[model samples]
Target: MPAINAIAADKLVRLLGTPRSPAMIDIRNDAEFDAEPRLIPGAVRRAFTSIPDWAPDFGDASVIVVCNDGGAAGHGAAAWLRQAGADADVLDGGVIGWVGSGHPLLDTAAVPPRDAAGRTLWVTRARPKVDRIACPWLIRRFVDPHAMFLFVPAPEVAGVAARMGATPFDIEDAAVRWTHDGELCTFDVMVEGFGLGAVDGLARLAAIVRGADTGRPNLVPEAAGLLAISLGLSRMYPDDLEQLDAGIAVYDALYRWCRDATDETHDWTSHKPAKSRVRA
Candidate 1:
């Protein structure tokens, strides 16, 4: 049986990128982390020695601490968090266990340098319709929960990225690594690049995003509806961030549908079932 304070590696995997996922803290030592520089999706790295300084930031929120092998580092950090009044747990097998379980670990190398406050900053073309919003949604949900974005004119994307230390995406440039690859849109590349290709729902959503963003709504049945909604949203909020705040909820719903309700259908006939069946 699993310990009351420990969450199994596989069990944690299912909640890795969801909105209700517990705060994930990676407490691997410097040497261990140097050997493996990746991080589990949505996990933030923190020092075990600095737990006291950071633990308070958790503020009674549930946290799951991970280490290289689920040994002293993870358990110790989780314990410290619990002592601070947070509902904290350790990952049973840690990062190694997650890798051994065949779950994807994000390649930290692809992530841009975080700001002083520890948030990945990115720049892209302004007036986003589909790819821009989808990419940020993916980042906030899976890569960095506190990521920031800057929207600028199309011609200014690269210049802003250079001056502001932001990673540029979805633009025409040989150096921009996050742009489209052949038929795949930026969202698809990110999903694949961040090691989330194996996630069935994200892959499905990526296809729809790709289809909608690239002007090929016929590629997926959901693409047309997504495009229509995205267009409407673009008109609703001229301010990019305001649009994004509203757009997040849209993607959140679409992702849930992709993950949990893909086969579900609703029609007037179902609600108007025969009286005998309705009673039962």
Candidate 2:
């Protein structure tokens, strides 16, 4: 059995895609990572030697520390994080346990460059309705939990991205790598690109996003409703970032519904019993 102080990989997997997910820190050494360069989904790499330098940065947030096999590295980091006044835990078996459980891992090589603060910066068209919001939601939740977005005029997306060093996305340009790919929408591309396809619910949500964003509502039954809600949200908020902040909750609900509540139905009398079995 694993140590009681650590959480199982399965439990952490379910938490990874949600807002309540703890800050995940992978503290594997260079030689260990050279043998396996993948990262647990939604996890960021931190040098074990620099724990003192970075531990204070996450003083207010809970953290999960991971190493090769739940040895001295993760233990030391968790201790440092706790010493810094943050709630922290170690992975039960570290990356080995995570991979052994068949959980998803992301290819770190495919991830875009991060800014000074370790956030992936992105630019997209302003006045987002569906694709733009959904793509950011996907990126923030699954790809880079600390992703940054800048909304600009459609004509200036590429220019702003070049000048500001942000990756341009959800806009049409042959040079851009994050746009729609033929039949798939930006959300679909993002989900696939970030190696999140293992989650069947997210894949279904991607279809809905594609249909909603691409004017192909017939492809998914929920597409029209999503589009309607997205447009309404856009109208409600004048600030693009405010709209995105709201959209994050929207997609969060949608993702949970897709993941856990799709087959569920509700009625006022769900708790009420039938009329004594028809008085038989």
Candidate 3:
């Protein structure tokens, strides 16, 4: 059993893709981080020595502290965060344990530069349907939990991205860093780029995203359903931001279903239909 103060890595992995996921704080010392240079999915690096300075900024959300191990560093950081009136816990066994258990880790070097507010900014076409909404969900859930999104008119996407130093995605410009690559949707590119393809649920979710975004519904069982909902969401909200906000919840449900309940089935029958004893 996990200790009262620590959460198991498997349980945390289940929570990582949802909006209710705790804020993951990597408090590993510089030397240790320099060796691996990757991050737990959705985790942000914070100097362990400066928890007092940074702890106050996390008041809006609960926090999880990760160190080299679930030892003194993480436990102490969680203690300090709790003292500061935030719900906090240490990741049981930290980075090593996460790796040991074969959970996916994001390649932090592929992350875009953060703005002054310490959030990644991404610009994409307004009136998003599938891929655009899915990409933001991936970023928020696994890449940068605090990433910012900017939705502009389709014609102005590249210009706004350039002026604001935001990465433009799901647009059709050869110069843009995040456009479609051949047959793959932007969602597929992101999954490959971030090294998240190893995640079984995310891989399944990616196939659905690709099929929905690329007009290839035959590729995945859920693609047609996702495409319908995404298109409906686009029509429902005139404000692009509102549409994206609502779409996040849709993807959240799909992700959780993929992760936890993919094999589960239901029917009206209390037990398997009487093997049909057909008038033998």
Candidate 4:
């Protein structure tokens, strides 16, 4: 069994793609990290020695500290974070344990450079309907929880990205690596690029997103519903950021459905009385 302040790898996996997941902090030393540049999904690299400066930044939020082997570094960082009043825990086996459990690791190379505040910034075309919103949702849930996005005029996306130090995505620019490839939408590219294709439900979700964004809703039964909802959301919110904020919840629900509820079905008769069922 794991220690009281340590969470098992399998248990942590359940929380990874959810909004309630704790802030994941990777405190592996330079040499250890150089050996394996990937990170647990949604994890950010932090220096264990610098906990004094950053621990308070978490405030009362929950945190999970990860190290090379779930040894002194992780436990020590968690202890320091607790002292600073943040609720923190160590991963039971750290990166080693996480890998041993056959969980997926995010390819750190695919992520764009972060700003000084450690948030990945992205720029995209304004008035988003599908892929634009879906990409941000994927990035926040699986890559960088604190990522920021800039929505600009389609013509200005590239210039804004260059000037503002943000990565441009989902546009027609050939230079943009995050755009669609053939029939795949930007969401599909990101899932594959970030090494998240193996993540359960994401591939299915990507298909839905692709079908919705590319006017190919016939690709999946759920794609038509996603497109309808995405268009409705775009009409409801004129402000791009507000629309994105709302769309995030939509993707969250869709992801959960794809992951856990795909095998289940519901109808008016699901909760009907036994007498009504017998009569039917």
For each candidate in turn, the TM-score is 0.92, 0.95, 0.92, 0.96
lDDT of 4 by residue, 29-147 (tens): 89999988999999999898888889889988899999998888899999999988889999998899899899889999999999999999999999999999999999999999999
Q: Is candidate 2 or candidate 3 better by lDDT?
A: 3
Off by over 4 Å in 4: 271-280
If the candidates were sorted by their TM-score against the true structure, best first, what order would they fall in?
4, 2, 3, 1
Model 1 misplaced stretches (Cα beyond 4 Å): 269-280
- Clashing pairs for model 3 are none
lDDT of each: 0.88, 0.87, 0.88, 0.93
Which candidate number has the best TM-score? 4
Looking at candidate 4, what is the lDDT of residue 157? 91
Clashing pairs in 1: none
Candidate 1 least-lDDT 10 residues: 271-280
lDDT per residue as tens, model 1, 110-194? 7889998889999999999999999999998889999999999999998999999999999978778899988889999999888
Residue 233 shift from truth in candidate 3, angstroms: 0.7
For candidate 4, the 10 contiguous residues with the lowest summed lDDT are 271-280
What's the residue-level lDDT of 41 in candidate 1? 85
Q: Which candidate number has the best lDDT?
A: 4
